[model samples]
Target: MAESIRTGRRKPAGPLAYAALVAASLFAVGPLLWALSTSFKSPDAVLTDTSWIPSAPTLENYTIVLFESQVPRYLFNSVVVAGATVLATLVLATLGAYATARFRFRGRGASLFFILMTSMIPGIAILVPLYFLAVEVGVYDSYLGLIVVYTAWQVPTVLWMLRGFFQTIPTSLEEAGRIDGASDLRVMVQLVLPLAKPGLAAAAVIAFVYVWNDYLIAATMVSSDDKRLVSVGLYNYLSQYGIEWGQLTAAVLVTIVPMVVLFVLMEKRLVAGLSAGATKG
Candidate 1:
């Protein structure tokens, strides 16, 4: 018993469990692997070759997407919009979350409930209203319109996430800051926020991904080619002529690179933040 405890060993996973895990992973990753394989094949090979490994891989698809298409422009637009949305959402969510977590005020419960309820409403339900409002405000077909809409849609959820994370932090830290003559703003900026880095990282990644992948709002809010986001710009691969599957797959892979890099860099913090937040609320 002492040796078993010292080794900290648990029961090994049965073969069935390993097989189930493998099946689930393959199910999730199969499409992406297919897309990657398709991206490397030539136009003729894309239609004729059904094999996972291409007979002859070519870079023509990547060349068309990178040098000859507007995909680069669209990628730039997505980065700008997603970055702004994440920044604005974090700033607003952090303040709102801290207030809800640390202070008691009139209608606090009702206010939180209302915010959460707004998130439950489908985006499609408000599409028409948002469109007309954007047009009336003279922001249609502009980056500002897209960023504003994305920020508004993301704020409630991010606020809830950060609020739960804030609750997990000890009040003793804030009290100590107060005792040190720090104001609320100073306490938050210098101490609480520093300690909440994992939570902030998690919230920022969520907001960024939401804006990056959104097509409905991007398509409806902006009509100009220059302002189009990656999600909307991918439609260029489809036309009356035909779908350019090789180029389309290449572009798809390109668009996912940023998100992949972000996840790789922030994996540890994101996991820690989510685990901590979930434990408390």
Candidate 2:
């Protein structure tokens, strides 16, 4: 009788919960779908009506954005600058993190905390000084300038993150390497690094994404249109006459796809890295 009654009854979440889930899903995907629809839409349709999908989808926007506009150059610049920034951040942050983690030096906590405090400062606050320094160093208006700027800004967070990750690594591993007559560098390279792979992957992904999407430093540091990164390049789509909604949407979506693909491919590694330290700690 109990089993028969249970079979007749319905499952939980009758109305409100299901509605909320459906609404949340739509909310998250709506904008992306809209952008994709807009990218293929006619300029007239974009302004005239609000439709989820384009009535007459076209590839003209992509063609014009890729061939006629400076979008390709901006894409190239973003890749170069972001790539360089990530590489620099990884090397500097990893070394600093290792030192902070393994060695008990004077004012270590104070230094780490102070370094982290800079994250709270708005980029606008230091823009003027950074611009002046860029000119002084003769790297202004150059890819190197933007890369260096991003590296400096992003490294502190990476250092803090990696320091925590490095700390979570078991000391016994290093001690074992020492027992086997391995040098400190060898231990770090062979054992410690191998164990900390997940953390490094997470840090790299974070650094790459931050630098790729950075706009403030890119705009201030790179003056030449040819050297502009994607974020600033999008501003060019706006004009006094009107905004090129279709072209701009196409450009934005194309710009986002690569990073999205990159993240999706490495998401597993990134999650593992983020959890590795936390789980151990």
Candidate 3:
């Protein structure tokens, strides 16, 4: 009788859940879709075309931005800066996080708490002093200046991330490496790093994205067109007279696609690393 009743009554397909998901997807994707549509539209079509689909698409804007502008140079600058920042962040944060995770030291708790709290501090608070410091160091308006500043700002978050991930690693593995006559560095490089690749990858990606998207710091430090990062370089489309809507939208789409592609590809590792770190933390 129970089996008969179960078979007779079918469950609802949960249209509400599907509807909610669709709404959320639209919310997240709306701006991106708009940028993409604008990127393809002629300048006149952009203001006139109210529909998401472009009524008259053109490639002139993309060509103007991609071929005739300093965008390529800005992209190269961003890559160099972001890459250097990631390497520095990983090396320093790894060492610091491992120390905090494995060693017993005075003020360790306070230090970790302080570092975490600093991450919440507004960038605007430190902007003036940071810019002055960069100029004083003679790295202002240069890749080295941007790289150094980005590394400093991004290190704390990476430190906390690596610390959480390190806590989840069993100490026995390090002990085994030490029993094999390995030094602390050897153990970390040989054993722990391999195990922590997912977390490291996640941290690396996050650091790179932060540097790539960074605007205020880079803008303050770099006034030269040649030194501008892509985030700030987008403003080149705006002159004293007016803004280049079509080219600006094209640049926006170009900027977004690479990061979106990277996230989509590495989302599995990112999610696993973040979720595991959250649990341990």
Clashes (backbone N, CA, C under 3 Å), per candidate, total 0, 1, 0
User: How high is the CA lDDT of each candidate model?
Assistant: 0.91, 0.85, 0.86
Best by TM-score: 1
- Candidate 1: deviation at residue 185, Å? 1.2
Error of 2 at 168 (Å): 1.6
Residue pairs in clash, model 1: none
* TM-score attained by model 1: 0.93
lDDT of 2 by residue, 1-281 (tens): 64567556767776999999999999987888888989998788888757887778889989988998888888888888888888999889988888889989999989888988988989999999999998998999998888888988988988888888998877998998899999988888888888877888898889889988777888888888989899988886656226878888898888988988997899978877787663442
Clashing pairs in 2: 198-273
TM-score of each: 0.93, 0.89, 0.90
lDDT, candidate 3, 1-281, per-residue tens: 64566456787549898899899999999988888888898888878897888878899989988899887788888888899999999998999999999999999999988888988989999999988898888988888888887888888989988999999989998998899899998898899988889889999999999999888988899989888888888875566227767788888887777778988998887877787674577
On TM-score, the stronger of 2 and 3 is 3
Global lDDT of model 3: 0.86
Top model by lDDT, which number?
Answer: 1
User: Candidate 2: how many backbone clashes?
Assistant: 1
